[model samples]
Target: MIRPRRPERKAPPLLPPLKLYKAILRTHVHKLPIELRSLGDEYVKAEFKAHQNIDNPLHIVGFLTQWQDYLKNLDGGSWQEGKLSQEDLDKMSPEQVNQLYELMLETKRLGSEG
Candidate 1:
């Protein structure tokens, strides 16, 4: 006998990239500290620009999902307490790991300067 099919769960629709980018910059980034606001804005601009030509649905979904989570964290005032889980770090490619390291160093440098 065949097993019954489970109902498919639908994810909430994501905002379009341009709209989400504007929300992050206009609504969220300005709430950050001066140093962090500049850094976050630059990073967000670069990330969005880099992904502008991406055509893969999964990649787009994943990118938007992570950014949406970031927006939520900022809105909730818990963004400063966020940390990368080891499991999430393990999934990064070598280039991504290096990029993360560079960002960390830059953050530290800014922190020391402030």
Candidate 2:
């Protein structure tokens, strides 16, 4: 008997609900988890991609322009602007937390040195 191999699954696209995406960018974190965070991320990506295509035009041009501006300023450490909450860190086990924090700090140090 021949066995068949299973196909690999692709990561789902990030296309967020319009209102929820705006809310997240607005820093309404408490309400975010009440809905679906993963779904929100998916929707954002999908919308961004859709607007990026030649077929359908959208306001994404402004967003892409801002991203380009940010990239141009990437010589400094502006890439890492946001902070992760202590509550979020505390939820992880000590080993995982230490590893993640160590890697994050190392990345920041390297970015700052350059």
Candidate 3:
């Protein structure tokens, strides 16, 4: 009996984690509001550190894609928040929820300052 040939898999492109991390932090410094810049920097640092050892190509691509989109939005001054659904909130850890709250407060504070 003849066996069917398996499809060839293409490898995902390699992304330099440290370089991307620095680039994103720099973008945040320039694009984020004064009150948010530090918080955003910390968040990115923690996140990058957490994912520094990721070996899954698909996961790496997804992560890079999301951050790239975020950087683009920041560059364009189009960063905005949308309402999180109940399910979305349920999926977040308490710390994540608190961070969101802090982000909201930062935005309000910046608005008042300006």
Query: Which candidate has the top score in lDDT?
Result: 1
Q: Flag regions of model 2 displaced more than 4 Å.
A: 1-79
TM-score per prediction, in order, is 0.86, 0.28, 0.61
Query: Stretches of candidate 3 above 4 Å error?
Result: 1-15, 81-114
Q: Cα deviation of 105 in candidate 2 (Å)?
A: 2.8
Candidate 1 structure quality by residue, lDDT tens digits, 1-114: 999999999766788899889989985445788888888899999999999999999999999998988887887888888999999999999999999999999999999999
Greater lDDT among 2 and 3 belongs to 3
- lDDT by residue (tens digit), candidate 3, 1-114: 999989989654444777777888888878887777887888888888888899998978877876776666777877755366899799888987998898788778877877
lDDT of each: 0.89, 0.49, 0.78
The RMSD (Cα, Å) of candidate 3 is 6.3
- Which residue runs does candidate 1 get wrong by more than 4 Å? 1-11
Report lDDT (Cα) of residue 90, candidate 3. Answer: 100
**Order of models, best lDDT first:** 1, 3, 2
lDDT of 2 at 62: 47
TM-score result, candidate 1:
0.86
- Please estimate how well model 1 matches the true structure, expressed as its whole-model Cα lDDT: 0.89
In candidate 3, position 81 carries an lDDT of: 58
- Model 2 local distance difference test score: 0.49
